[model samples]
Target: MPVPRRLFRAPSRSLLARLAALIALLVGALLVWTLSTVYEQRKLMHRHQAERELQTIGRLQAQAVADWRTSRLADANALTDDSLFAQAVARWQSAPQTEHEATAFVQERLRILQERARYSVVSFVAPDGTVSMGNSSKTVPDAEKKALAHAIESAAPAIVEPRRAPFFAFPFFSLMAPIFDGTRPLGAVWLVMDVRTSLYPLLSPWPTASETAESVLVQAQGKDALLLTPLRRHGELETPTVVSASDTARPLVQAVAGARGLLYGRDDRNTPVIAVVNAIAESPWLLVSEIEVNEAFGEAATRELWVLSLPVSAAVLIAALLLGGWQWRARLRESALKDKLAQNMQWLESAQKAALVGYYVYERSGDTFTLSPMASELFGLTPEAPVARTQWLAQVHPADRAQVLAGLDEALRERKPLRMQYRLVDGSQERWVDMWGEHDAPSANARMTGTVQDITERQRAEEKLGQYRTALEALVRQDPMTGVANRRALTEALTVEWQRAARIQAPLSVLMIDVDHFKAFNDRYGHLAGDECLRKVAKALARTVARATDLVARYGGEEFAVLLPATGRAEAQAIAEKLRLAVRKLAIVHAASGVATVVTVSIGVATAQTKTAMRSEELGRAGAQANAERESLHLIHQADQALYAAKEGGRDAVVAQAEAPSSTALVGSGAAPDPTVSPPPPRST
Candidate 1:
């Protein structure tokens, strides 16, 4: 078989060549337009990615605080009643705390909390600002305490210690929240967690010059910024010479004030950098990434064009007449690849935008770079800006200049991406942002690429979760109707108190309350009215267990239970007697049990301490047994029988149960003990 000979020959005329040239020119123009469009789209995508990264880092930090609060709420029975903050605050307000007492408390708490957290530092503080318990390597300064006091006195409701912990030797920062007594401010509970741990999850990427990239957390306070470098920004390279910290922070502040994010540049040791400046939630923090742009996009992008142009030129000359066909094929394939990339990039950008993300690229060659939609929006610039480098930095936050410069110098030398968080005073409002990216030494100059994101919602969510958690805990530990400890609640409280009593050798007391003839009262009045009567009875019990360590809970259908820490049987009996009278005074109507015209109650008291050989559970059971042995299931079960002795011997009275063999036995008719008032066996709620 023979290959078909070329069919058409170029017409022997100059006009034919001219016509072909025109078509070639048109194709070339189209190529440029299409390629430029693809590149532009890529820029937008980069911007969005940067922003998303920032938001993620911010959220992670915020969630950490929320988790801490949740852990505190888990022990609802012990934690809610004698809130440490509430107690400490009251003590501090009432009088100067004895240094010995304050120190001992903090030290004890510290030893107990010696358990290290993988991501945070936990500790307790005294009213006089003494560090009682913590293992954090970083030190808290007195100035910080003053600042905390000011913030506590300001707008903060319950939010204390609102900033990230600073890296040791880099910067010192942390926050504290004051405890409260209703509306009164108490001593603060401090939280100390390093910012690096919070940012690592977000700025893990951004390749380096020699595989080196750095990240920094910029703290913007007024015209000053404290740059927290994850690693030395410029390894072996001395910190860059900068005018002042304001130079780095001011531009970002202005950008945020304008509500426009900024993607600009600076020359750190003559190495070009592209920075994406953004605000964190409500904190005074900013996230800035200095990207090594040239190595990242310059050669790669231009090299792609170089390879493509050469092949097309060769094809054009090799088969002049078929040149158009060949070029068209190449152009189409290339366009498709570019289009796919652009589309994927678009998707990434959209996802980020919906997530409040932005991206950027830096040109190490000291020329220009591109930013995505989010980045453009960050700086209030059109996507058509020629050079998004130093020209735009004029609007940076003055407060963050020093911090920003330090971060840049470190990033370039270390050849690593940097992650930073800071607050910017944009116009009148403060905006927060987080950023990260790396350096590229391969581009002849240093550069980096990274992302940023906004996390206002996440910050707010964490704060709200704390308040919600408190409410949930309260629901679990309190009686829904009377705001007293429910039966289950009292049991748990006793368990904890027993352990504490053993440790301190203190006494713990229990009071068992029963409404006399409650069943008859319910039967006479409708169940609805009976509920009200029970509620009134519960209120009486609540008042009896009013101490900080006391627990009052619904014991049963018509009874309530009280656990009083540090109280003996004598004290418990006294309190119980008061409760009995308070209930009798209600004068609730009871048409059923013809014996009495009003509702009354009976109570049993028991006391035990760590010094006792018997377990709290056993002691409680014995008290129940005594009540059962001495009384019937009716109001006078024990009290009624004794009262009957007092009343039939009198009327309306108080009584105690004598010893018995069985658990929770009742004193009723000698006819085998009228089985109704036996105390129920224990079980966990």
Candidate 2:
């Protein structure tokens, strides 16, 4: 028993027990460290993912808002460039009392635009910012007066920022387009839009399904940040939806402060949120896309809990092995991805260079451009330097500068895709360049992205082709010997005049002239003399019908036709008589002539008094045009019948048919009737 006391107090057993306790403690510590590292890394990864998603959404919403602003400006610009609308506005402004027609026209146009364009109100504002005419009400709110004045004073289009007006329950904005009569400022076209109907919906939708995710637009006002859009998550905003701009912790305030990119901040509700801030291009507003922090980190929290519950020793060992293996694999994967990315980048660069196409990003706010190597080369600039707006414009040829700037202005104003071909001055050489540009999302900066290609050779080829086409068209429409319109050209002219006469309820006249004895003259003097005689007759007829609107054409062999728009029967007949005299006055000797000793022509005249107005429903219809064309052919038929009558009655005479031939004819003096020819049949009414 005494010996057992010594064995019971074994030091080896005590030492083993202490060692075991130390090992357990070390394992516990390692597990704690590993769990902490894993949890932090997981949270960071989740937060980064959320930030990326939020940023993407923010950019997209910012782009949508910018596009909306641009579209409104475009709508205004459309009216500004419309000459008809401008003339109406001018007349209404200058003589509102006497110009009832102009007033009605302006009102109707404004009404149609309001209804079709889905605007709350479309109004014409006076230069003094007074509502002169409108679709709904002629009231210019005090809030919008400043913007209207700016638009008119600058003689430019402008956007009124969103604000709650006394007349509207919800926030509203205006698009003002100034109207100018030549260099004189007339007024502006004001378009009012209810933000709830037009813009709020753009920010309402979230790309992914999330309960707390929402997009908002913010604008800085003095020392406050005003909420431009209603808070989608928190429901309708209260009056004076603004927060202190000094509150940098608030996402809206941060957005207004021009802080872009992802950040951790509290929302208006004081709830912690992860948000991405972006500025809307060409506007004072900023877009913030946010989600509750709790929701974004929920999955990471659950994973952390599971890791914490694992047995300390086993979990620590497993984590170490997994970490090592993951790091190894991640390195390999990253290396492979880097190589692939390099290869893809090389391919893209080579393709761009080979195609002679270069891309550029334009910072609209900064008035600067960042060009790729190819783009820089195309612009004849150093590749390393960013191009300024002025420098970029200077690269454009002088002849094309205004056009290019105008196009760029329109593109930026509308956020629309642009395609233009213009000449560029590169060094001492001028080269033609075709450029295509499109709007990129206005995230961090307002920008335009596009490609430019050297198209000098292509433009030259197209110009040459156009010249050839013009020459061919001339050959097709003109007679080679007479240098006057041919039969095909005459037919086209007749159809066009007939339609015009029908539209305007005007009179149309046709004169058909024929050489009395061309066949006999040709037989006696040969083809060369016949040709010369025809040329003379054609020249005389062309000279006789001297009005710019009138057309004289070689109808066929030895025959000519004249088209007189807005001419009555009396004038037509007089012109026909003059043409006959003009030809006979040439006095070309024709030994075989029966009508006179000299060459003479018989003329038939027919007039169409289109006094009947076309029905309103028939306008702009293809079938109606076809019918008009048919009526024109009938007119030609009437002229031909009169020509036959003139030939039959006697050579070298003029026969006119307003509807149907009433008299025999007006025969030439010293002309004998051809006994062999008979009177022609009556023409159809």
Candidate 3:
């Protein structure tokens, strides 16, 4: 400044100035790039909003269907209550044997039930499927009546069927429940509800005016389905295409094939439309909502247009006129910046080395790459030469490579964060590393910036934790030696099964299993070997029962309980026989009988769907109205009687138990008893 130095002597333009100029040029370019990036982010946000809207509709569908099914189930359960049928049958059965007496009794019942059950009519059927009594317009048509009497259900407390009625020629969901003489099916009661009107309130505000959307209920089977149209979207044509499970029209079949939740409907052409589905509880139906492109993206498209242009124009305006001198300075600055950039890059390399972690960027579009010193160390490099990702991957364990790529690809495609643990070799020795990454979609290649850390100790701890959890879970539920449920487990299972049976008209059965001569056997054999014998029997039970619904548990002492949820008596009996035979096969010594053979067990079978089923299947010690409740007394009495009967009849057999209905017995209780009922025809071994 003092001497007014010439251009050559202006301190060689100073490296700092040059670098600052280069930074300005780079910043200008970065500002343009930043505007583009912001535009993309806006577009992504709008798309995300659409996804959110669809997800909301999906939840709405699920809730609507659940509400509908719950209503129907409640109606069905109320209609099939045992008390109503018992009252009708008791009056008819107790009185004179004349047809006129029975017909008169039936006519009175039909009128009372039609008013109470909110139905057009109600009718009665004898054990032989004959309609002995009815005052209703819908009598048992000949076609259904022929199939009704020998309906193969010797113990269906209630049944549902399709029948002809005067109100609607088209068949509706109909049911038949029997009055019981102990375990016998005496007569039947039928109930029906109109599907469309009864279910209208459940599917409300559905064809959402905000979006041209409608929700439908479809029944999904293996590959075919039944459609129940509840709501219609705008512009959606009601093309009733009845495609079968075995339809040869490949496209239609595939579209409706899974017919799972959240599906779209297309015209006969199978064009694209967006749909979402949710399944109704306990019923074979699905609730689905569909949206058109216009409905789904109309607002988003408008938002995208506004979001794209404004920032870009501002960036362009800033880039013009005022930036020319900056550009000249930037060009000169770039050359000097190389050295400074080298220095900054060295800091990154040093930072990675100090941290014992590695940084990596996976570029989906380009093969170009760079590695820090720590990354080089992880990939078996000598710290003399840098390692490329492709070469580093070559050193990765083969089993892990496919998994790593899958994680990487997923991160790249959906722009989702990813994490993975895998092994890599360093100097012929394996080292485990855990990696975490953030997906960056702004990059054309959809890159990931991730960090990796050695996690060999963490993996070992995880394995130990898994084993501990399994052991703890087993301790909570299982018998130590037998690998069956303990008392606590059985109680939980009973609650779960009871709720399920109540929800669906599905049957649930229980067998109060007790080993016949266990005290004698234990007296002969030591407790250790007795424990072993139980283990053997439990093993047999585990093998013999075919269905997953069956659960075996040790009740207390030598007694065990088998919970057969969603099973009828026939199925329960089948499993019981298998279990009984399986115990005989074990051959544990019965010391009292002087035989070194396996112990035998007598099973008391009870089913919720049986005509004489008890409400308190396993009577609790206390209840809501303890003094007034006869169910508490009846169930305990019946179970004890059945146990005594099992002992009386034989050592190894099945005796089903039900309570005898007394005025003292609770009216709503499921138990119904008759003295004349006998054991079912003996099942073959």
Candidate 4:
């Protein structure tokens, strides 16, 4: 066929050309705006991720330091209760010449502890701050006498801040636990630990691999913030540098001044950094987890460059296509048109690759998928051939295959947008992908077009955050000493169980168990043996309570509690007796305990009657919930009173508190009680 004359006309500045130019300009501007918006959003997301990571590290380091401090204090407390060691000290002090064995025993104990606990020095200090016995010949510094006095007066374990002593080569801290003879305070057992060996290492490891990331332990010293641990930037130092508290740009100062969470500040080198601050529990210090701002946001900057380049590249391509179309208008033919279309397809593929997105079109009639090159790569398929429906399905993870298929079928049948996240499997590898699809032409051919994005990194980050959260929660709710539920966990469990029981109109029972004359036991055997005794008792109590719903918890020092859900007074009493018998069977000798030659437990049992809870329902749901909480507390109070009655009567026994008409006028059935005795006040869990 002969070419039309208009098709071969010369290029001119006509209305159509002017309109096309204007449209191109607007499209280019819109493309830049969209890319800029995406770039900004990505930067914000990067900043948020950095802050989250810093905060996680800060919390973790803070928790670690707190645990370390607790362990030190625990060691001190255990040493203080060492009756045999205390007697040895007493004999050595009274008569050093005649009591050579006592002197040798004290020296050996200190030496063994110093080696075993990795302490720099272990000493028995007298009330006047004199080192009576020590593993090393180091003398106590005059500057630390005040701390010794404080430990003796408080009669509790105390931590001395890390400092240098003439006798020690490296800076060290002291853990002092007061030694006592019954009610009178003797001296204190001093534990000297080198910070370099013990504490500084905890802050060295970063959760993610990075050279500039570090943790700093800072203490507020009046007008200055002292670095307790040396910064990684400075390598090793004989002494730490103190930053002025007035430096508002420093995260250490901000941390001491009560600022927490994310902060943008500078470090010792005055380099800008992104940091998170958290206070270490029970200590006058704060933890700063920081990284250089440049290092932290380096990837974001690269992404921004790429993000900007894409729009400019698109503009260039658009202009070239426009110019090429104008030049080739006169030579329009099937082959040339096909070549132009092929260029457009290449550009589309490049854009898809740049965005890390894969596109696919599924034809229901042929049960085949036409995939872009990126899509074929994502599915681990050959790009030269179309993929069958079965092959596509086989690539999906077995766990997520059914859901993906259902989403596809629904989108095709219902003619709606399909959006879901599922996993893809290729050999031994698994990946998470986010997908979105819609019917290309709902009224015509049943074709579904979709885009898939890899989100595996995001999934892994979320899972890691969840694990940290779980570990933190476990630390908060668990008892470090006995490996049982702490008081906080017990209280939370009680609240939840009470609410559940109230909902089902079931009975709830509580048991309060106390070791008989536990103070005397500690005084007789020393704190270490006392701790062992408590552990054995805890284990016995745990084993005796056979129900999965029953919880055995450490209520407090020398006290334990058991929560029994859906249990009546009879069953509760039986369980309490069994728990008592279990401890008796342990045959742990407790000569100090007057109840028996062996250790015994006194248990108080109280059950919340179903009738008592039924009355709470008369109030609305909110009121019922509130009343249930009050009832739970009241139940504990009754148990406490019953425990008192068990103690009043002979020690090794179980006393069940019987409910009366008034709730307050409850009496214990195990022991004779005054009819006029009123119920003890409700106690907070």
Candidate 5:
């Protein structure tokens, strides 16, 4: 039995209608997805742009703060070097009972300094922790008086942490410089500054001018984070607004703990913000620049709204047209299919260019290479140019040519895949390319097909990574504050130099240098000035020992060690004297030093010469090499003993000691030394 023609025709009509509806739905979905993708890309680009802008502003603000602090410190340091002020201070300190004229003159000079430097108050603090002269009668607090004594002892400028003045009851920060009369402490000059007027303004008026954009300076005090500078939205200027350190979302807490870069977190007002945190170099402060997330993304949101509307309107218009022209849908579908095919081909071409990849085929028997247009362009040749194996190899860098050829040859002989990364030079530019090849078994001729991808950016990134690793290694071997070789590096160098000296039968000299009265200097000048003083001393010692073979390293705080290979006791003594004289010539005032008015160093020099031979069985073959290391340690111990003797004999002198034969003999015999061996005498220089 056959079905009726009318039944077949009805089902065909229903199927056609269903197909048209399905097509309409599919087209609308595609349109929506494309619009969403475009909107997301635009939003991401805008967000990245904003983040970059914020980072630039944050760095600039940090630099400004650093410059401001440097300038303020320079002002205080310069005052310490003023001859007129020093002379007035000297006269007043020498005869305070009879020097009424000197006191008046010093007070007048302080007034002039106060006016010139825009200080709130100016005072002269006596060495006995008393405010001897001032424009006002307000007595200095005992805490500040102690700080003054510290500054005078260190003979360096000190910046007191901001606080409320005792009598005036105003928030202020003080800068104090020690008064020195030929390295003898006379008194200190104090300049108190209003923080609101001087430092608070640095945080305002952000670069982008958004309502919520702000930059702030924060300092960590105990378990609390204090807003050292003003806040744009909350808190009083120059007043301590403390927040808990446990709040990990707080940028101040993160920054104080040494976290950096852009972060998404809530501000003090609990508003969502994108913040960039940068630490001010050499200061106990953080510069945080933030803006509300909503405000930052406002323009991107508007653009997204427009993008959404465009696809919806297009969908409605397309739906209407499809329904009205239902009769011509079959023909339209055929034409649309052709257009889609062409578009897909164009998309593939574009994808290849974007990825920097190209295809190629190599015919081994014919010695020919067939390149796609993209591959030809990658090699800087005309598109669709006929390429040969020789021509392709010619484009390869001379340095990479041999390796590439070897890989190709091995792959051909073994019938294996070939993968290589090499450089290709075109004119003055060089590009890195990763080439992969596999045997094409289907081909009648011996052939391989593969892809070549431009990997220049990746190569450059790897090179940069290598350089950063090198820099990181160097930093690990260097002291961050003093810019000298650290103890670890010094230890490694000593080991190498010790072994070399033993092999060559040369003397190895070690100098242990300790800065005189360093604790007193640090107590007086504060840690920042103390660091500066150490940096100066380290640099001076480095310059004093110009020999490339010699190593000057910061052994520890206020202590440095110099390793001199192939040097004897007399020469080491002369070098120690030169170093001592060099430090004295620096004329760095050390008011609390008992040895000299200026900064000085006590050096202990020790020299070791190879003189003893030991039985192989007694030394143990493995311990033979350890003997040199043992001797090096013994040398350092002797130097430290000499250093102690120099310090005992009054600092600012050089002491010398020679390595004892008993120490080496004991090491070879594997016997510990007795506790009752008398040490060598101090050879004063």
Candidate 6:
């Protein structure tokens, strides 16, 4: 009866239970709204981050492609500027009878270069669109010939568009540079490199480790975007894949139209992707880096869900315990916020460390410095250690200390922003740092605050760039084979010395020396041995001319020239005799030589008294400067005439042509040249 009565009375709801139910409903609604807001914000943030990373990768790939093309063009230009090649071309152009020999020489050179540079083909294109000389037997295409003509007309190097070669059916591109004889265009030298092997590989590598990320190149073709390089994911598709310009959904189409920055578009596969585009400098190509949108954002969504769930669960637990533990709950919430703040600070510090950056505050009046933890670590000091101005200065590299100090003083006096780069030596280690600081208006107790970033990598890159510049200059001025000054360098030195001689009224002497029976020597020992012999001769000549002002250069094949400033005919003749003897001392055997059993030289010395105006016509003409330059050429002609005279008077002798002396005179006239002084055993041809 009692149980029946209690069940019928029904359970009366407790105040706590009703309040708990209401609280639960409110908390659930709040969590739903907050999670939605957080998810959207997180989604936007992830998208922005992906866009930034892709943009950076796109820009880097574009720069790399541009640099690669630039380097190839530079190589072609350098080859065209070769003195030996120019002289050979001049000889062939002036006298068609020498075509056979000149063609053989040029073909040999092209073959060597092709092997060294790994080119598909290298050709010398004549003005009439004929292949004068080439490494490959393949005929030059009409399109390539027209491009070469354009390059010759432009008087600069040109890069042709990629095309498939008929012979190998492989993709290739041409680099052409006009060959010049002073102001006259002497055809063009062109190189064909396989794009599949040389260029496509450079653009295919993605900077990111993610498999979904890739880089591609696109060029505008009519009203469509043409894929210039292969896609990493879809390797089966042939390059130059065409996409309509109206396809705004395609990143490549947008890129071809010069659209840059992050964009949402579909890839070739029609899959949604996040892409960044950058235009290649100096070319009508665009570099695109893209990642599948789903792949890029999947993890972000997962992380966002977890983050939202964690806060919701924590809030529900707090609400459940609110009735009996309100004070404890409040403390917990405060502590949680503090922990979050601390976590954010920790994250900021981590980011700064990763970027190799640090912050600092300098008190000018106290001459003391306060460094952030990262800054202290960069200086190889404990974070807790007090930093003094003197202590900081002591860490600076000895070589850079003066500049750093002066820069700081200037910045303080001017009350302006300061930017400086210097090296820091901590113990045995050295690091490069870029410091940027700004001070407020000058006052008795002004403070300077700014950031310091470690730029060691940038410094290394700059040093490497400087090294490359030095190497390029060496390629321009130094002979590749003999490691001496090239003809171009010789010409420049001659012009400079001529002007200097005119100013100082000093004599300028030139020695034009030729290796006797060099052709016979090459035929006897083969071209490889011939090259070795030339190197030896060049070394001997370089050793003979040790003065700082003296220059020894490879003028042409089997020929060398030396420039001597402030030297009279007598001194020049003595130097020429010394050079002749030096080559003889090498004892390179030559049985075919009529001059000597060993290698010998014919030397012609010419001395000009630049103080006096030798040509009256040059003195009166308005273009006297031009005529004076022509007089320098006249001096070279006089030296050349003497060279022929030396060869005429048998080899291994020095002939001098000077203003005061007769037209030509042989040096060491009394003695006959030694033939077997130190001759090697001759090999029969």
What does candidate 1's lDDT look like per residue over 1-685, in tens digits?
8766677665653554456556555654554454445455545555454444433333443343333334333222122233553564455446645645555554433332322222244443443566543354333456556745664576232222323223333222244544556665555555554444433433444422423233444554444444443434542211221224444434333333333343444434545444555554545445555544454344545654454444345433433444434445656544544544454445445445544667777676664556778866665555545554555454356687678667866876667778886554457665566677776555557567787666555555555655655554565566566666764566555555544544344555566665666556766777788778878877766665555556677754565666666665566567777877787778876667555778876666555533323333444755534442222222223322343343332234444444222222222223232244332222111
lDDT of 4 at 257: 84
Clashing pairs in 2: none
Structural similarity to truth (TM-score) of each candidate: 0.37, 0.44, 0.38, 0.58, 0.52, 0.55
Q: CA lDDT, every prediction?
A: 0.50, 0.75, 0.56, 0.76, 0.75, 0.73
lDDT of 6 by residue, 1-685 (tens): 3566645754333554555457555755655565666567656856766665566556666766886676577678777667777777777778867588886667766765675466877777776666744354334677777777778778777777775546447778787777888777887777888887777866665544587788877788986888776678777336447889888789888877767888889986889999988887888878888899988887877776675566556555555555344234557544544554454455456545655778888889888888888898887765645578888998899999999999999988888899999999968888999899988546778999998888786677557645755555566578778999987688777776665555445667889898888878878888899899989999999988857778999876777899887787887888888899889999989998988899999998888864343332434443444544655666776787688799889878999875533221111111232233322222121
Model 6 clashing-pair count: 0
lDDT at residue 627 of model 3 (Cα atoms) = 24
Model 5 misplacement above 4 A: 1-339, 442-444, 523-528, 611-631, 660-685
- Report the poorest 10 consecutive residues by lDDT, candidate 6: 662-671
* Regions of candidate 1 where Cα sits further than 4 Å from its true position: 1-355, 360-434, 442-445, 458-470, 593-596, 612-685
Between candidates 2 and 4, the one scoring higher on lDDT is: 4
Candidate 4: Cα lDDT at 38 = 52
CA error at residue 371 for candidate 5, angstroms: 1.8
lDDT head-to-head 1 vs 2, winner: 2
What TM-score would candidate 6 get against the native? 0.55
Worst 10 residues of 4 by lDDT: 664-673
RMSD of each: 26.3, 26.9, 20.2, 11.7, 13.5, 13.1
Off by over 4 Å in 4: 1-20, 37-56, 132-139, 205-208, 222-224, 237-240, 307-311, 317-349, 359-377, 380-392, 403-419, 427-429, 436-451, 457-685
Candidate order (TM-score): 4, 6, 5, 2, 3, 1
Judged by TM-score, which candidate is best? 4
Index of the highest-lDDT prediction: 4
